[model samples]
Target: MGTDWVEEGSPSSSSVVKTKRLMEGLLLQGKNSAIQLQLLLKNSQDGSDGSGSSSEELLGKILGSFAQGLSLLGSCSESASAGHDRRVSPSSGESGESKRRLNLKDRRGPHKRSKASQTWVKVSSTGEDNHAWRKYGQKMILNSKYPRSYFRCTHKYDQGCKAAKQVQRMEDDPQMFQVTYIGVHTCWDIMKTPRMLIADPDTCVDECFPIKQELREDAKSDLTNDNVPSADFFLITGLGSSDQPNGPASVSSERMGFDDANGDHAVPTMYPFGDVANSHGLEIDSLSFDGDFSFDESEFLASDEVIELRN
Candidate 1:
């Protein structure tokens, strides 16, 4: 199915081609009609007043007919296209597989065919569309009731495509917002325009303020005395005495102890990989120190201590 659907000028291209043909046909007809009108007007000037009145009506009718022909041609060119924009409505039945087909009338462009200025983008939905997704993992979050489902392209290895999606069903609605990523991972591109590229509606503080090495060192130092002990306790409980070790004991040791009575950890979390962290590279301190960059910060970084100096 790779090349089956990719025609040079798909339906849109064909519709445009048809429109051009119709305009050419109409242009030739209009030229011939204009020549006939010119000849009639020259002869009518020599005739009586009644002859001039009849000639005006005849010319008007010819122009009116030409206008009607152009309109009909536009509709016909649209109809001659290949496919329709199919929209899937919520199913009435429980089966979920049921779909109703809609025939949307095609629209033709004016004589000037131009590409759409704005791009049409789509977010994926597990329950909404007919596309298939493969499950990568299920994460049991501490506060949230439902676990987040991570998905990667099912055709990834076969097609060498790196599209991925994260599906978290809304607590209020049954509909899941499946973000269908079109392209592969381009983290640099995303980091360039943090606000525009990143879909997170959350604050830009994370990107604006890259984690300072001093703060990170402080966090590590703060945890060095306390975390090591708790992590050691976690290792003893999870591993149950294994020399070889079944898996990476560090995960079970560090993560499990972060939980409280509700089994949720209380430690300030840092990213596992330094990919994003390094990209920002101490930019956060400058942004944070500067009063202009930091404004209306929420729960993420609630506490900020500013030392005042008397001038």
Candidate 2:
């Protein structure tokens, strides 16, 4: 999944070039891994020593390295591409490539957003043309290694807030995205409820992070065997206006619990746009999502067809 970071740069990042490099790397590593596994499996098959074969161990190491290399490749082209490697190797014959057919459909499109981009804007809710949105789909991209999810504005019926976001999984870290938000939506309700800003982080966000931790632990096993970080990494953000021209409104803080099966580490709950932007040195009070600024209710209501279609 960490490999998907490069998918953010896929438009300009040549999938052919990167895939070839990765294929060559994986082939070499895979060959070595297979050999090691074969030795270990042969030993196990012989049923000799009480110590079981280490085939699974070798295979796990090989896959982890393969995923890490792909992630590094994707991270290199983060700005130019969506970090998605969509191209299939023409050299791989159909007979042997069927099982490894590079799934390009999961790659990010030209205008899509990736979690790596790290840019988000808060929409104002005071406008009359405010729209609504709903999440439609989410998918995991192969090769580059993260899943991408889709969202569409509900106001498309009449308000036409063609806003969408492409949720790209972090190949190196399943819990993070390469998250690219595409159009600006006037929907006030888009952020009303705290949504799974990203899909299952345990299966996704923590993917690469756990691998890294394991790798680090392996390097330190000679000195210590603790499998957790020494210090916790936590980021806290607060939102609301200090000046009470309208008095202080009781604000409710939403906590998102990201579960990880690996138990490597915990990612703190990320706040919605409501509280997040304010803490990021941005003015949250000035933003609005209302859509009625340009027209009167009578005129808006007169367009019954538009209302009906939107409704």
Candidate 3:
């Protein structure tokens, strides 16, 4: 009976070995076919002769190999069960549980962030924004020349602000930076002033900065009447007083071609604060002047405009 049992086990083992060998050969064939298919696709993209027939043939072979492997796997399991009345051994059960755990781990894919909660802006300077950001981390992105810098709101811990941003220099234009902001500011240190109105330089109080008016009404009117987002407002600071002996010259609307009160002249505007539109993704023009002005960093920090929509 022992000899008979040994002979029976030998045939089962031999069949399993043959099945494994066949599976390996099929896997190798499929790998080679996939490599050839990839090369064919590359050649086609490169304007080479890409016959559809060859790719279809390779794909069919790969599918056929997979089908045969599955069929073999089913047949092997059936044969093994029929040949032996074997219970699942303790070691094999443990091994299967370990494999299941590994599969669960592998299936836990990468975490994804919602695009709706994020805002993207392209700017010339990374540090031009008024918000205080603390650099947390930097990462070298794949296929990108420059590293991306991650920043969180400075008031994150103290004030519970959830604002965060990522800054990366553009590969094509190194001078330009891509800034991505996540979440709105909920901190108390935020500027609550209304958006500034860009009137003719002649209407400006100091001749250097544009008129300061409550822009919320105009913004609402633009939305209701024109079905468009309101223009961007900037907080202009650091302009020297006209009383200063060496202060920068006062800008004139006539010189800048904004003298037309009827809005006939097309005043060319510069986006020094970047093309930050309102929260609704509406782009508004920014302020520009003809004369030079010195920017005092302290004054800029003290009187910066907190454009809510710009955030």
Work out the TM-score per prediction. 0.21, 0.25, 0.28
Candidate 3, residue 255: lDDT: 15
**lDDT string, candidate 3, 1-311, tens digits:** 10122233434576767875675566456546656766776788899778878876765564345335433443443343242322232332345456667555444444333222323343444434556789989999999999999887776666444557778887987876766665434343323211221111111111112111121113223211110011122221111122221222211111111212333211222211111111112222222122333334454334332222221
How high is the CA lDDT of each candidate model? 0.31, 0.34, 0.39
Which runs of model 2 end up more than 4 angstroms from their true locations? Answer: 1-23, 50-57, 76-79, 82-311
Give lDDT: candidate 1, residue 260. Answer: 36
Please name the candidate that would achieve the greatest lDDT relative to the true structure. 3
Candidate 2's residue-wise lDDT over 89-177, tens digit each?
34433454453445333232343432222223221111111223366898867787766666655653333333454555556655544
lDDT of predicted model 2 = 0.34
Model 1 clash pairs?
A: 124-178, 124-179, 124-180, 209-284, 210-284, 258-265, 259-264, 259-265
RMSD of each: 28.8, 25.0, 28.5
Overlapping backbone residue pairs in candidate 2 total 55
Residue 138 error, candidate 3, Å: 0.5
